[model samples]
Target: MPGLRIGALELSTPIFIAPMVGITDRPFRAFAREMGVGLTCTEMTAAAALVRAPEGVAARLLDLGPEEVPVAAQLVGNDPQVMADAAQICVELGADLVDVNLGCPVPKVVRLGSGAALAREISRTAAVLEAMVRAVDVPVTAKMRTGWDYQSINAPELSRALEDVGVAAVTVHGRTRCQKYTGWADWDEIARVKEAVRQIPVLGSGDVRDTALIEARIRAGAVDGVVVARGMLGDWNFLEQTVSQLRWGEPGPTPDFADRLRLAKRHWDAMVVHHGEQHGVRLSRKFVVWAIKGCDGAARLRARVADLFTQADLDELYQDILHAGEGPTGWHRPNFTSGEG
Candidate 1:
């Protein structure tokens, strides 16, 4: 695993934490960066929103610690001028790179002709990327699905178009827009895109469930790097595990109950500090589920955590999980390939 260079920034490894809406908030990005992810991105911020209220959006989404540098700001929208302006705002607000979210499959975004919807029209996509690249001094990149649908796979041609417009790199999520993460990501299609773009780096996204899958994808010569999305949920050490395997041929060890609990507590504290207790508790509900997923008595724990509204509530739940034995050994993990994250 060699370092990945996107224009001026150099990543220590090719393992990137994909910009996940609601999930990749500042606290999460900080945690992943501290755990040694190569690159971290902000959750997809709307281009029009940022242009209209740069200060407010920056305060809300662009906030980052000094240690979270080399982070990319991901923006999604259909208007070229608005996208360009948003990219410049992100650059001004300390983004090391600016990434366009052209692969998101959410119906709301697609309905607005953003995200995967952009893939339906090559000319519009090219124009948007060109505008963004020209607007920002920092590296400008795009993340896209293979195409709008299986019937119209155009990643190879799209890759060429993006490269021609001076994109620093592109990430290809192997499924079509129609697939919306239902099936396995096609590494072969990713390889085709890699081959099509001779100059810039091509990254693979989707189905990055474990270190084995990450290694297999890279070893197959399909992508220079990978964007770990849902696979990273509840596992801060996931990137470190992949990097360890790449460097030492061992993924170290699976986090035991105590380690998981400690990390979960840290995440909880950060959320509370970043957003007050009321909202933080609400935001942490899903995180609590992810933290305790596959653990012994997880169902009961989730039920209890759902009604939690304060730090005391969280403490009691943590105590309960600790009292239980380490979760079922060798627990099963779903192959979450959905790019909805």
Candidate 2:
């Protein structure tokens, strides 16, 4: 497979890990990169927050390790100039690309006239993206839904406008804001966006759980690439498997229970080092839950995760789980319904 070139930055594979809020943090991104993900992104950072508090929590959202380079910094906002300034800040902080968030369907974000709300007005969204393009030297991209609702499907038109305004690539999550994560993604709509754009790459997202799905999309010429979102929750090695399958027609090795436990331990340690013990332990619980999904005694393990307050507590649990010698012999498939983007 040829590398995906967005502007001057080239990715070894076309498979991208979505910029999921709260899940794609610095530690998690670094881990995904090590797992052979073609490209990674920071969690969606609010442009206003970045502008309002560069030294605050919003700035911390831009945190990236050297190992996670060539990552896109995703920004969410409606103000063109503020979004522009935020894009500049992202570039200054070493983002290889800046992606505008136009697909997030969360009520809080939509209420602010950002996220999917931007897609409601193509011209305004284009103006915001144009300012961002002019503000940074890196490639500017946008991730948008099909439209506000089934009655207002407009990704094809919106994608064209974004392309005209210097957006390098567009990722279409094949659902309208109204559908949220329910129902099947409209790949037909995604294909329409691909047809609407004349030059830039068009990637597809939503419900992409396995390599075969990616192969089907790419082979059908509906999308230039696939963005793995919730599918990557517990299965950190998903991207690696995807790359192998796409390139070699082989799904590659699946990690067993012991392997997963070890990986989970490594992830826990990294989270601790990145966020400190107190916050890190709490932040890492969800990841632990994801990792243990489909494993024997998973429910019991999940119940214990809530009480984990210290490294020693996690360590004790890890040993017990390891000694229990339970879980799938093959790769664990994450239960996406239990989580959100």
Candidate 3:
């Protein structure tokens, strides 16, 4: 797993953290990078919303480090002009690449002909892709699905079309818009899309929660890389660990349970510093649940932590989680596949 190359930047691995609204903000993005994710994108922001200053959302999503090169800013909307304008803003703000969102299955987004809704209108989708790619000198990428539904599994054709317009890469989430994350993703379709295109990396974007699924996708033969979405929310280590496995051909030695917990705490502390205590503790709550996933009593801890708003309260709960167990057992994890949505 040598770092992935997107135009001028070479990522250390193919494991990029997919942007999730209200989820993949700056602390989360930086945490993933520290843990060795190859690339990280901000949560999807509306192009229309950017008509005003995007600074509020921008502050939450932006990060730049020498090692975290090729940072991508993902934008979502229906209007070709707004998408182009917003994409230009992202590029000017130091984005190494700009990713257009086409696979988000959220109801609010799809209803607006943004996200996966764009999957239904090939002409408009083509227009947005071509305009965005041409609007900025930076490489343009797109994240999309199999189609709007089973009847519309048009990714292969769409992939070809997007490539014709010069999209540097395409990520295919196996489920269709109608599926709404309810069924298994059509990975074979990802392979189809990859074959349909000639000059870009095609990434498999669904059901890749761990190394096993990753190897399976690579074996299927269409993907140049894999994207981790929900699997990364609670565990920042996913990317770093995945990279070691891909690079060394072996799972690296596991870190101690306490080590994992400290990493979580550092992330929490960083959040508190970055966003202040109230919001930090609130945001940190979800991560605590993810960090303590493998342990017994995690549910109870999550319930308790939800009400906590102060630093001391967090400290108390964190200590309780640490002491309740005889020792750290690392994170609890799930087989979260986009198809499972």
Candidate 4:
């Protein structure tokens, strides 16, 4: 597949990471960049919080190192002005791009008529996209589901509308809010959305678990790009493998047992540096379980991962994981409920 361009920015490769709530945090993004991810998005930040408590939200969520450049900041909310204000703030804080979340299926977010709810109201979605575009000089993007539900599929129409208002790119997740993460993604609908957009890039996100899936999607012209979400959780080498496959017609080298452990250690250290000792250690637990996936004796190691409370505990657990034999013959894919926001 060819490279992708979103406004003035150009991506040499089309593989990108989704803005997952608990998974795509700062440390993970930085680590992803090191591992060769083309672009990374911060987990969704509430537009209301960015407007009402910019300082706190910035301190807690939007902190970015210089190395994390070319990263997009994703904001979630229904209000046009508020979302715009938050987009501006994200730009001020060094975001290379700002993305609006119109695909989050979480009940709490949908209750406020935001996320996938916005897709149901095209006028409101247009207003929100317009506000965000006008609010910042950087590129503005929107991530949406096919529609609120299968009965109301509307991504093609919505993509055209977003393009009309200067959205730099559109990412369509093949499932609707009502469907949540169940069932196969409708690549046909994703292709329809791509066909609807005239200029801006239209990326696809849903069940992209490996390089072959990515290759198939791009080869089918289903989308201009692919977003890897759950696929990245436990597998640090996934991006490298996908990128190599896309660019050279071959997947990248796989990390052996020691290499995997070393990568996990670096990730743990990064989490601590970015989030601090107590909190970072706690956050590392899920990632640890993910990293240990497919390794031998992982089942035994996972049961003790929850007992981790400090950096030392994490170190000891890694030791235990290392001491345990290599994991299952084929690694298990990390499983998480998929949706944006």
Per-residue lDDT over 172-233 for candidate 3, one digit per residue giving the tens place of the 0 to 100 score: 88888887766677888888898889878888887567775685566556687888887666
lDDT for each residue of candidate 4 in 32-80, tens digit (9 for 90 to 100): 7876667899999998987887476665667766777789999999888
Total colliding residue pairs, candidate 1? 0
Superposition-based RMSD of candidate 1 using all C-alpha atoms, in angstroms: 1.8
The candidate, 1 or 3, that scores higher on lDDT is 1
**Selected candidate, larger lDDT, 1 vs 2:** 2
lDDT over C-alpha atoms for residue 72 of model 2: 92
Residue 201 lDDT in model 4? Answer: 86
**What's the distance in Å from true for residue 249, model 3?**
0.9
Best first by lDDT, ranked = 2, 4, 1, 3
Give TM-scores for every candidate, taking all chains together and pairing residue i with residue i: 0.95, 0.95, 0.90, 0.95
Residue-wise C-alpha lDDT for candidate 2, range 206-282, written one tens digit per residue:
88887987887887889999888988777776777898877877778987778867987898889988999999999
List model 1 lDDT by residue over 1-341, tens digit each: 67788878889888888888888888888788877778999999998888888586665666755667889999999899999998988887888899998888899899989999887888899999999989888999999989888899998898899899999999998988898878788888999999999779899987787787677767777788899887877776777798777666678998876786788779887987888899888898878777777778877887898688998898888788778646756334444554462
How many steric overlaps are in each model, in order? 0, 0, 7, 5
Once fitted onto the true fold, the runs of candidate 2 whose alpha carbons sit more than 4 angstroms away are: 54-59, 327-332, 337-341
**Where does the lowest 10-residue lDDT sum fall in candidate 2?**
332-341
In the order shown, the candidates' Cα RMSDs to the true structure are 1.8, 1.9, 2.9, 1.6
Best by lDDT: 2
